[model samples]
Target: MQPTKTNIFLYLVAILVNLLSFSIGVSITWITSVIPKVDGSTITDDNPFGRLLTASEISWIAGFLPLGAAIGPLAVGKISDKIGRKKSLLILGCVNILSLVITVFAKQTVLFYISRFLAGVVLGSSYSVIPVFMAEISENHNRGALGCSVGIFVAIGMNFALVAGPYLSISVYSLLCISPLLIFVPGFFILSPETPWYLAARNDEKRLTKSLLKLRNKTVEEIHLEMTSILEVVVENETAAKAGVRDLCTNNTLRKSLLICLVIICLQQCGGIAAVLIYMPKIFEAAKTNLAPEICAIIVGVFQVFGTIVSSVVVDRLGRRILLLVSSVFTCLTLVTLGLYFRLNLSDVVWLSWLPLFSLVVYIFTFNVGLGPVPWVVMSELFPSNFTSIAAALTSSTCFMNTFIVTVTFPYLSTFLGMANCFFLFTVVTICGAIFIYMVLPETKGKSLQEIQKLLGSCG
Candidate 1:
C-alpha cells in the first residue's frame, strides 16, 4: 500500500533527526583521517602536538569514545524519561557540538582524550533514545524501515569522514563535522514535534493533540482515532505502577526483550565491525591491498551506505528475522574468507591480492544490510513504552561496552594474533550469533507493540 502524506512527513522528520548519526559517524572515523598525521612520524602543518603518542595512547584515543558512550546512556535514560525525548536530543546535540569544538581546539593528548570521551557520551545517549523516539512516533508497519534509516545516516557520516578526513586539516575537518548539528540543533527545536507517546505518558492531552496535529497530515477524525489508540496504551500503563529498574528483571516480557536486544547487539559488535570501521584505512594497509588504503576505505564506506539504504527499503517488506539470519550467516562466510585472504597474503600470493578488497566489500555490505540495523530495530520494538528508556539505557551501555572492548583491543590483537586470526575469531562469534538468532528470535514485522510483547511472552 502507498503510504499516506502523514507517512511521508514521518519519514522526513526521521531523516532530519538522524543527522545526529551523521555527526557521530564523522567522530567515530575521524581517527582514520588523523591517526597517521599525529603519530609523530612526520610533523605536518596540522599536527597539534609536538610530542609523539605511544601505541597505547592511540588505542585509548580510539577506545575512549566508546568508553564515554558506555556512561552516556545512563544519564540520558533518566533525562529522557523526565524531560522528554525531543528535549533530551536537543541537549545532546548541544553537548555534541561542544565536544567537537573541543576536538578542533585541542592541543594536548589529554585534551584530545577528554573531547573524544565526551563525543562518545553523545553517541551513547543518542543511540539510547533516537530509535525509541522514531518507533514511538511511527506506526508498526513502517517502524522497521524508519529505524533502519539510522544506519544509513551513520554510514553516510562514516563515508563523509573517510572522504573528507584525508584531505582536510584536523581542525577544519572537525568544524565541518560540527556543521551538521549547527543546522540540526536549531532546525529540530523549531520544526520537530514532540512524540505523542511522551505526551500521552505525561497525561498532557492538550500537548498530545498538538503533537499529533503537527506529525499527521490527517483529518481531525483520523487524528482522534490514532490518539485513542495511544491513550489506550497510556491507560493500560497507568493501571500498573510505573515501571522501574526492578521491572527489567521481574517483568517476564521486559526481561526477555532486554535479553534479546543485548544478545543481538553483542553479536553485532563482536563481528569485528567496530574495528573495521574505526580503523578502516589501517585494516586495508594491513591486508596489503593494491588500491590506496584511503580509496579502498572510501569504497567500503560507499558500499556501507548503499547497503543500509537497501536495508531501509526492504526491512518492512522482508521481516526482521530472515534478514538478520541471512545477514549473520553471510557475515560469517565473509569474515572467514577475509581471514583466509589475510592469511594467504602472507605467502606473496599475487593472484589473490584482489581477495581482500572483494571480501571486505562483501563483508561491509552484508553487515550493514542486516546485523548493523536489525538489532537496533528490534531493541526499539520489543520494549514496553514504560520501560523503553530504561531498557534502552541498559542495551546501549552493553552495545558500546562491547564496541569499546573490540575497538580498544583490536590493535594489540591484530599485532599479536595477526589480522587473519582476529577475523577468524570474529568468524567464530558470527557463527554463534546465527545460531542464537535461529533458536530464539521472533519476527517482529507488522506487529504492534502489544503484539510484540505478547509474542515475546510466548516465546521459549
Candidate 2:
C-alpha cells in the first residue's frame, strides 16, 4: 500500500498514544528497583527517607498500586465516555505527572504508598483508554499492529526502569520517569485529533468530517462511505442510550466478547507474569547466575521488548490466534522446565543451575509475543465503540485485581507451596489457557469493528 499523508499522521498518533503506555511501564516497574534499596537493613544517613522500611511496609507499598488500579478503570471508563478519549488521556497523563512528583518528594512511608496507588490509577486509566483510541483511529488492515503498540511501549518503559533505576537515586529516577509525560501531554493536546468514531458518536458533523478527512487519505467519496458506516453504528448505539453491565449481559454478541476478553485477560495475569516481573531480581539472586541480579532483570526486560516487537510485526500477517497458541505452548513448556529445574536443584544437580535464567528469558519472550500483548489488542477489537470504554474498564479492572493478588501472594505461595510447585501451577494454567485459545478466539485480523460484531453474532 502506498503511504499517504493520512497514513503518516495515523502512524504518528499511534506512536504518541503508545508513549502513554511507555510512561505507564516506567511507573509500574519503578518499585522493582526501589524496593531492595528501602528494604535493606542499612538505612544510610544519606538516604532521603533516613529510615529503613519494614517488609510489611514494602509489601503494602508494592501492592497498593494494583489495588488503586482496580478502582481507576471503574471511574475513568465513564469519564472517557463523557469527555473524549484524547482529553481523558491527557488528564491521566497529568495524573501520572502528579504521582511522579509525589514519589520524588515523599518522606513518609504513607506518602510512598499514596504515590504508588496514584501510579496504579494512571495505569488503569491508560490501559482503559489508549487501546480503544488506537483501535478507533487505525485502518483495519493495520489495526492489529497498531493495537499491539501498547505492549511494545510497555516493554520499552519496563526496560527503561530496569536499566535506569539501579543507577540513579530515588529522586533522580522519579524525575527521569516524569520526563516522557512532559512531551506526551502537550504533544497529544496540540498535535493529535479526536478519533473520528468518537466525534461521529457525538453528532458533531463539521468536526467529524474534519476528523475523517485528517484520518483517511481516500477520495471524498470513500471518506463518505467510511463516515456513513461509522455514523450508522453510532445511530444504532444512540437508541440504546449508553452501554452498561446490562448491555453486556443482555446482548449475546457483547456477552460473548466479554467472556472471551475476560478469559484472555485472566489468563494473562494469572499466568504468573506480574509476579515474575516484580520478583525478577530475587529470582536471579536465587538462581545462582554469575551475572548481577540487576543485569539479569535488564536482560529479561530486553527479551520482553524483543518479543513485543516481534508480535507487532507479525500480528497483522500471522493473526492473533496462531501467535497466542505459539506463546501458550512455549510458555507452558518453559515454566514446566523451570519447575523441574528448581525441584532438581534441591538434590545437588550442579549443571541445572543455568536453567532458571534461561527458562525465565524464554518464558518472558513467549509471554510477550502473544499472552502479554494480544489480550489487550483483542479487548480493543472485541467490543463496539459504545460499549468499549465500560467493557475495557471492567476487563482492565479484572487484570489489575489479578495482578494484585498474584504479586502480593507469590512470596507466600513460594514459601508455602515451594517455587517448584508455583511454577507447576502456572504451567497448568498455561496449558488450560492454550486449550481455551484453540477452542475459541476467532481471528480478528483485517476485520472492521462492525464486521467483528457480525462475525461474533454468527458464531455458535
Residue-wise lDDT of candidate 1 within 1-460, one digit each (tens)?
8877787788778877898988887778888888877775767787878766788988999899999999999989999999999999999899899988987888888888999999999999999999989998888777898899998998899899999988988899899999999988988888889899999999899999988877788767779988998889878976874778887888777778888899999999999999988788787777777889889988988999998998999999998988899899888998898888777774267777777777788888989999998888999989778888988999999999999999999999999999889999999999988899899899999999988877998884
Residue 251 of model 2 has an lDDT of 85
Candidate 1 CA-lDDT value: 0.88
- Taking all chains together, each candidate's TM-score versus the true structure is 0.97, 0.97
| Residue runs of model 2 more than 4 Å from their true location after superposition | 45-47, 217-219, 240-242, 346-348
Global lDDT of each model? 0.88, 0.87
Summed backbone clashes in each candidate are 0, 0
lDDT of 2 by residue, 251-306 (tens): 88888999999988889988998889988887777667777889889998999999
